[model samples]
Target: MRRRAVVFVALALALLTAAVGIWLAVAAAARDTDAAPPVSVSPSASAAPVTADDYCYVEAMIYYRVKEQELAETLLRKQGIEAGASGFATGIAARDEDELEDLRAWYLSWADARPAEPPTDGPCGGHGSDHAQMPGMPSWSALQGFAAAEHPDAEKRFAEILHAQNAGMIALVTLILEGDPHPAVAESAEAVLQQAEADQETLQGIIDAVP
Candidate 1:
């Protein structure tokens, strides 16, 4: 009877030890599982605004061209010429110094007829004038003469060409600076900018030549 009691006590001790070992293993595993993965935070995304240089360049070019067009349109209007017909006439008209001089005279006359109104708005707003009458703008007739003599297609064709070229150049530059990955695209864009720069000089020369 003593041997049997000793054996029963030994067996109970062994079972308790095994159960404790299993519980310890599970606890260790639970701790390791919880610790394995690290918590992570994602970065916030945002876009940069366009720079002042970009805005200024685009705005100045557009303003300059549109002002020229307005001058041309106004000149045509003053001559009792229908807008569409005058546009067509300018496009097809031969370049003649005498004709251009006559047109300039007409433009100056129209300008002289209007008494200068006091500026209600700032200089940038053309002083609240209907025609944005400011100093150094070629008279409407002079603009018309310029269109007729220098660039018969100045209003439509020349403007369209310049606008398209500039727009493409701007887009290309923007894409490259924005980190476009395609090598071919980046190279093509660079080439376009170079070409457009060259073309810009020619256009400026034409603008300067307008009498």
Candidate 2:
């Protein structure tokens, strides 16, 4: 009888020990699971905020060229502009129209879609009035004044405005070149910068000759 009682107590202690071991293992696993870090998720490109870069240079250039082209065509339509000024306006109109078409195509290729015509009202808006804050962009009143001027005044006004706008575009193109622009955008910007520089030289001569 004594031997049997000792055997039974030993069996109970072994079972208790086994249960404790299993409980400890389960508790440790739970702690490890609780301590693990959360899985991270990346933000989507489409979720990019409006304040982000969004290739402002490309769109801004398009806007600038559109306005420049319009002004050039306006000058061409006006009477009494000197032969030199008329020729300059004609070149500007033609060059900008071609560039505008190229830019539209480039934008479509880059974005996989076309940007809105006339753009929306912000930096991303290709032709937004907000971009008027850029240096050398003529104000509404200045555009009106240019439209109304005649003869020598018209020539002088066109030279002054176009010169300023050209300088602004050159600066913008230079900035894009300095930064990490897309290959297509960089190529277009380089062409624009070169043309704008040459145009500026011509415009300077025109301004100097203005009587």
Candidate 3:
């Protein structure tokens, strides 16, 4: 009887040891899994910057957007077309600096990315000087016409200018968004376009309410 009791105690001790070993092994495996970094199954997103073949793309892009922004600002301030339009134009005008900053960032990145190559592609069409001035700038006479008018006349003139300017902006925006082809430029262009869309609605409201 004594031997049997001792045998039972020994078996219990062995079983306890075995159970503890299994638990420890499971705990270690759990800790290792918890510490492991999660693996991404898909590739990370990539940002695509523009690769300019020439400087004309650069010159044309800057001039085009600047003019559009300037036009909106001037019309809003000088003509006093509508209060709501002023807000919209204000939003549009603010983008000029933002776009400029984007261009600077793009150029710096371009240079950094191609330290040895030195951007041998040169200006668009083989020369930067070949780029022409941005088209559709209102003449001095037209400027005077809008500024000189009062009330109904000024509003009418502003509406004409607003539509015309927006038409011109489309192509210029397309150029920077795709013409120069920089990620920064494209993003800025998209933002500008979004604001322009909102401005269009505002302009319509202004026309409806004031006229």
Candidate 4:
């Protein structure tokens, strides 16, 4: 009987030892799981806000071009000139339309991105008092004169206007491509500049043929 009792006690001790070992293992695993830290991200560090000055150049450009192109189209129609003239005015209407649409889209985007500040040169102040002007821009009188002149004379005026606009376009695009952070704006700027350069060459050729 004593022998049986001693054997029973030994079996109980063995079971107890195994239970302790399992408890210790489980506690270690739980500790390891709890040791992992939570992850955190900072908003300021992740996305920096773009400043108003950053996009002011584009805003000014878009505003001026929008007005100028609108004026060109209206004048063309009012003058009873051929918007689709075989040579000099070839596709001028269509090109102006496309440019106007692009300018409107870019203007809205730039305006949204820009902070509230004094209206820049290109943006029309809701009141007549404010007007947006751009580099290489011609006077209102010059635009008016060119728009009113007839056929051959208007043709010469067109060439001069084209050259001036092209010069401004090239300079403005260079600024965007070099300094602007917006990728889409930069791409659009490049596309417009290329088209302008091509248009300039064709318009200049037409002018050269005039005399």
Error of 4 at 24 (Å): 77
Best by lDDT: 2
RMSD value for candidate 3:
28.9
Candidate 3 similarity to native, TM-score:
0.49
Ranking the candidates on lDDT from highest down gives 2, 4, 3, 1
Off by over 4 Å in 3: 1-50, 53-61, 68-81, 104-136, 175-180, 208-210
lDDT of 3 by residue, 1-211 (tens): 9965654564454335433533332243245544322322223212453355322343444554455455554455454355655665577557654554434333333443432322333333322242322344455456556545555565556556565555555555655555554444455567666765665666566566654
lDDT, candidate 1, equals 0.37
lDDT of each: 0.37, 0.61, 0.48, 0.51
Regions more than 4 Å wrong, model 2: 1-54, 112-130
* Steric clash count of candidate 1: 0
CA shift at 184, candidate 4, in angstroms?
0.6
Whole-model lDDT, candidate 3? Answer: 0.48
Clash count per candidate: 0, 0, 8, 3
How well does candidate 1 match the true structure, expressed as C-alpha RMSD?
Answer: 38.0
Q: Is candidate 1 or candidate 4 better by TM-score?
A: 4
* Steric clash pairs (candidate 4): 121-132, 121-133, 122-132
